[model samples]
Target chain A: MKVLVPVKRVIDYNVKVRVKADGSGVDLANVKMSMNPFDEIAVEEAIRLKEKGVADEVVAVSIGVKQSQETLRTALAMGADRAILVIAADDVHQDIEPLAVAKILKAVIDEEAPGLVIAGKQAIDNDMNATGQMLSALLGWSQATFASEVNVDGDSAVVTREVDGGLQTIKVKMPAIITADLRLNEPRYASLPNIMKAKKKPLDEKTAADYGVDVSPRLSVVKTTEPAERAAGIKVGSVDELVAKLKAEVL
Target chain B: MAVLLLAEVMGDDLSVDSTAKALTAAAQLGDVTVLVAGGNAAAAAAEAAKLTGASAVIAVSDASLANGLAEPLAALVVSMAGDFEHIVAPSTATGKNVMPRVAALLDVMVISDVMTIVDGDTFERPIYAGNAIQTVKSADAKKVMTIRTAGFDAAGEGGSAAVSDGAAADNPGLSEWVEDKVEESDRPDLTSAKIVVSGGRGVGSEENFAIIEKLADKLGAAVGASRAAVDSGYAPNDWQVGQTGKVVAPELYIAVGISGAIQHLAGMKDSKIIVAINKDEEAPIFQVADYGLVADLFDAVPELEGKLG
Candidate 1:
């Protein structure tokens, strides 16, 4: 069985994002970019599945600009057999939405026919958290989202999902979709040797038009503004003073 | 516009507080018709009917919906989509799982975790982990959204809306419900709790988390933890409060020993009153705190507990 892992290049998690002064969007001109943390977990899970012999081949696909090939190369270093980059037009790249990404993935799935697709539950940039479910709906396939644990057994996979209340375990058949959560696994760093070898891995390039996807955003960002800031208050000298302030002001 | 509000139900009863808040959000759009879909949903439907904003309740009881597997639940919602111009649910895990599918099937975009309604088709939501707020306008004929219950007040119980039976669609039979391992806690839920006490990596070990629980118990608050604490195994994942975890806007939030990573602040910065207790006066958490106390939490927490006692 083949496993398809979709990775995204996003602003590094540690960087504090600033909104552009023009209110267009976030300022991402020279920010450090890396594979989304959750997608790294997804790639790790797919690589582990391949290592365990449950998956015969691992294919990493990314939908973004030309720079996204670097993300796919990182995935190859992690152990994906090949990579595919669906290059988006410059205008489309600025406003790519989850629905459009899902449409493109659906087209890719039609061609690859991977038994399972693993994706991050949410991207740190948009935080849409909709691609996997949208792909599942578009394909009429089963979906087990927010998966913290996944154990593939023959044609069925038992997934432990993190829900609002607690943990829920469900069994989903193969040819399904799974979105990786935070606690899924710790991703491995690409060794220098592996990074060098990833350069030789075959990478196929395509475009949004090739998939017959419009790549147009349905939701328009009317405005972007910094959230209201909370001003710092005076520090209390002692526990008694803190309690007094809490009683007098807060509680 | 007619609105369909998905009810979050546990067992035979509704999650009243969450559903009530969802109803309040739905009321902002139009008249609400609550959909209670689950294995034993009659009681939940009755409870939803009591919410002030609901005009009607549709109870759908199906064994397949008992666990809310996404396939069947999405199918059920899509089957009933024609009657409503808008579909809304609380931004819980179930809503997050199912609403996108409904939106996709309807060929519309989902505006997620909506903090405010700007109209029938526009919403304001947090982006970049609450660092920025974006006002989004959707031109889709049908609007699908998930409301953060923390941003809305729960509708009171006084209505006597009529409850009617709703039809269930065919189960895809592609997934099976195994079991749920829920953490049984007597304390209030983290999101709805009026007061929350959170610990961070400075708490040191799992044993030291007891101090957090003790302080929380004293104040009748829910215990929360930063991702560092959860990742370190000092607390469970469910107790995590951050961008990736649960977002809470409680009346009082106390951060103990937390350096206030931006991700952690994204979850509770909306809180009405925030207090920070950390040995490091320069911790970023102090920036958003309403009151700052530069002291060792190990000493401050115990002293605060004793004074409260």
Candidate 2:
């Protein structure tokens, strides 16, 4: 079985994002960028499957602007056999909607025919947890989402999902799509030697037009604004004062 | 425009509060038709019919719908796609898993975690995990969305909508339910709780985490944990409150020993009255807290719990 993992490039999670002053969108000029943390978990899981001898090859694919090449290189360094980059947008600020990205991925899946596809549950930038499920719907395959643990046996994958009430486990057939959650695994940092070898790995490039899928924005941004800041609070001296104040105001 | 709301069903009954919250958002657009799909369809539909702003209920029942799997639920919503102008569900785990597939089958994009209904075609939703809010206008004729339950109030009772039977979509049988090990807790649900008491890494160890729960029990509040605490294995996954976990906006949120990272702040900053109890004077949680107490959690938590008595 071959595992196909899709990664995304997004603003590093540590940086505090700022909204553009003009209410257009987030300020993205010169901000540090990296593979989405959740996507990094997906790539790590795919590589682990290969290391376990449960899969033959791990192919990593990314969809976005040309700068996404760096994200794919990181995945290659982490142990993906090769990488595919689909340049759907030119501007770094333009985020391709999940619908269009899923369509283009469907076109790619038709060509690769990988048995399993793993993707990030959501990107930190848009926080849209839709693409993996959209791809599953378009392909008529099974989907296991928000997965924290994924185990593969003969032809089935048992996935443990983090849900509202508690943990829920499900068994999905092979050739399915799995989306990684935060607790999935801790991804490893690429060693200097592995980073150098990743340069020799093949990195194939394509365009949305190459797959005949139109990547267009479905939702137009009317405005963007910073969330309202909380007002400065006063410090309470002791537990007695804290309880008294809370009871007077809240209870 | 007519709105179709996918009800969140738990076992035999509808999760009334969450479904009602989504109803409030749906009512903003147009008349709502609540779609109740699960094992005990009639029971959930009966509850859905009582929600305010609900004009009708479509009850879809099937054995395969017992466990919340995306394939059959997505197919069920797709089957009814032709009748409604907009399709929405609560942005819960099950809803998030299924709605995007429905939107994809209909060839439209999903506007997730919507915060406000600016107009019929425009909405404000949080992006970058609540750091930035984006208002958007949909170009698609049929809008598919998931309601962020935190953004709206629960609909009142006093509505008598008609309950109609809807056909359950055929199960694709691609996935099967294993068992759900749900933490049986007597406390109120986290999102709907009026008062919440959360612990942080400062609580130190799993055994020491009991003081946070004792305080929650005394106040009849739900128990919560910061990502720091949850990652440290001091609390269950469901107890986590943060950007990647659950978003909560209770009447009062008391943080015990939580330093409050930006991710954790995104979840509870909207709370009406916030209180932070941490030893660190410069903890980020203090900035958003209505009342900040600089003290050791081990000593402070016990003192607070006893004082509440």
Candidate 3:
């Protein structure tokens, strides 16, 4: 069985994002970039499945700008057997919409015929948690999202999902889509030897045109702005003073 | 443009505040018809009928929908997609789970976690985990969205919209519903609570979380936790209060031992009055806090809990 993990390149989780001065989008010039944190979890899970003998191959794919090859290399270093990079855009500033990304992924899946696709629940950049579910709809496959625990049985997978008030466990048939949540697993760092080996790994590059999919943006960004700032209030020295201040403020 | 609002129903009860907030967003576009679908949604449809501005309530009851397997629910929404120009749902776990699949099947882009309806075709939503706001115009004829309930006010009562039976959705049978392990609590729900008390990794361990809970019980506030706390096993997953966990904007929010990472700030920064009690004076949580107190949570939480009584 093969496990396909779809990763994304986004602003590093540690970096503070800044809106462009022109109100166009986030400023990306000289910004530190890395694979999305959630996608890393997905890659880790896929590699772990291979280690457990449940999967024969782990293929990591990223659909983004040309610069996303670095993210693919990182996934390869982390134990992915091979990688596919769909250069949907040349300009690094352009953000590909999730629907188009899902379509491109669907095209890739058709060719690969992987038994499972493990994807991040949402990208930290756009915060659009849609791709995995959208792919499931396009493929007419079962989906268990925000998965915390996953155990693959004979022809089905039992997954525990982190939900609103509690955890929900569900069983989806094979060839399902599973989206990783925060607590799925702690991802491991790529060793130096693996990093060197990843340089030799095959990374097949393709274009959105190659897949015959229109990677056009359906949503036009009218503007981008920083969130309203919150003012820091005076600090109280004692517990009694804190309570008193809170009382006066709320009342 | 007609709007279909999907309301999640558990047993026989619908979350009025959550549903009403989504209705307020739907009312911005056009007439809204509420779709109450879940375990015992037939009875929940009656409650949906009371939310103001709803044109009608459609109830879809089925045991398969009990766990909100996205495939079947998305199918139901797709079947009804022909009647409305816009299909919207509250940004709950179920809403986020199901809406995009509906959008894909309908061949449209889904706008998730929309904070504002700029116009019929445009919306303002948080990106970069609420650090940056982006205004987007959807080009699709049929718009599919999940409303951020924290952005809009709850629609008032005094409505008696007609309730009607809707055909149950065909189970795709791609997924099987397993038992849910719900953390049964008598306290007000974390999202709807007027006051929220959250702890972080600084609180130390699961045993130490009692002080946070005691403070919450004293003030009748809901208990929440930063991702650090939830990840450390100090708190449960549902108690997480962050960009990925739950977006809450209560009247008053108290951060106990929470250092306020950017993700944690995104979830509660919309809250009206913020109070932070942390030993680290330079903690980012204090920067957004309306009242910042530098103190040990172990000492402050118990004292504050005692004073509230």
Candidate 4:
């Protein structure tokens, strides 16, 4: 079965994000960009499925301006067979919401018709858990989100969802959408040989308009402002005073 | 413009805080409707109706929904979507699971964990965990969202409304409900607790976490831990609080032995009053702490307990 894994390029998780001084958005000029933390898990899971012979081919896809190609390359390095860069990866000005991205992805779904699709539960930057479900809806496919474990049988796959209290397992047919949770698996580091191999691997680039998707911003940004800054607090001298103060304040 | 608030019920009872918080968020839109999904949700639906400004309560009672499974609940919301323009829910795991499915089915945009409802079409959500705040506007005809429970006040009780029954949703893709391995502790729920006492690698060993538990039990607080502690096997994964873990905003957050890494801060910095107790005064957690006590937690914790005694 072919597996399609969607990856995203976002500000590195370790880097301290600074809002633009002009208050337009985040300052991404010189900031280091990396594959989204959760997307790494998605790619890693897809690669493991191929390694274990659960999937025949693993294709990685990314929707962003030109810089996103680098992330797709990272996915290839990790173990994806090839990559698809939707829209110029380098277009710094191109910003599309999850719904629009899903629209573009639906076109890829129609073209490739992969049996399984894996995505991160949510993106760290937008934190919107929409694309995967939207893709499932657009394609009318069964979806198992926040998947911690997955075992594929002949034509059906059993998935374990990470819920609030514990875990819930569900069985779904092929041609399904499965999202990766944090505990799904530990992502492996790409070796030097794999990185070199990824460079030679195929990367197909396409425009959002090619799929009849309008990458227009529907939501208006009337104004951007920071949250209220927390006030300065008191410093306690001793445990006794701390206990008394905490009791007086919180208890 | 009517807003639909999906209320998650715990057993036969309505999650009062979650219901109230969702209602408060729905109030930002024009009219409000609370849809309670569970078994015997009559009491919960009635209570939901008593909330000061709620417009109506629609109870979808089913033995299957009692577990709060995502697919069936999503189907229920989808079946009832035609009446409302905006759909809202608490940013709990269940809400997070169901909202995206509903939004996807409706071919609309979903804004998760919104801290402030700016207008009918716009909202403010925390980005990079809770460090940077991003305000987004959904241009879709139907808007779906998850409200941060800590961001809004509960809708006041005593308003009058009738509770109506809803049709059972047909979900062909739902997962089965098995046994839940809940951490049975007398402590309160971490996200909703007013006081939270968390530990980190500085707690040293798994046994050392007993100090945090003792403190939490004494104060009726929830016990939380840093990823380091959870990774070190000092605590359970559910207790982990960081950018990748649970996001919490207790009234009083006490960090013991935690150095306050940016990831860890992203989870609890929204806390109202923070107290940091660590040997290293330069710990990043002290930067955000309302009260900083420079001392070895090994000694400070026991002393504080004695003082409480």
Tens digits of per-residue lDDT for model 4 on A201-235?
Answer: 99998988788887776555544455567787777
* Number of residue pairs clashing in candidate 4, backbone atoms closer than 3 angstroms, sequence gap of 3 or more or interchain: 9
Give the lowest summed-lDDT range of ten residues in model 4 chain A.
A88-97
lDDT string, candidate 4, B219-308, tens digits: 889999998898898998778888777778888899999998877988898898899999998888888899999999999988776677
What TM-score against the true fold does each predicted structure earn? 0.95, 0.94, 0.94, 0.92
In angstroms, give how far residue B11 of model 2 lies from its true place: 1.6
lDDT of 3 by residue, B1-309 (tens): 799999966556898878999999999999999998887786789888988899999998887777678998999999999989999999988899999999999999999999999899999999988889999999999999999988899999879999998887788899998878885787888977899999999999999999999999988899999989998999987788887677788999999999988778878998999999999988998889888889998998899888774
Off by over 4 Å in 3: A249-251, B185-194, B200-214, B220-240, B243-246, B296-298
Candidate 3 or 1, higher DockQ: 1
Superpose all Cα atoms of candidate 4 onto the true structure and report the RMSD in Å to 1 decimal.
2.6
Q: Which lDDT tens digits does candidate 2 get at residues A130-164?
A: 99999999999999998999999888999998777
Query: Cα deviation in Å at residue B206, candidate 4?
Result: 4.4
- When candidate 2 is compared with the true two-chain complex, its DockQ is 0.73
> Which residue pairs in candidate 2 have backbone atoms (N, alpha carbon, C) closer than 3 angstroms, thus clashing?
none
- Which regions of candidate 2 fall more than 4 Å away from where they truly are? B185-193, B201-214, B217-240
For candidate 2, write residues B159-213 as lDDT tens digits: 9999999887888889998988775788988977899999999998889889899
DockQ winner, 2 or 3:
2
The alpha-carbon deviation from the true structure for residue A42 of candidate 4, after best TM-score superposition, in angstroms, is: 1.8
Tell me the TM-score of model 4: 0.92
Candidate whose TM-score is highest: 1
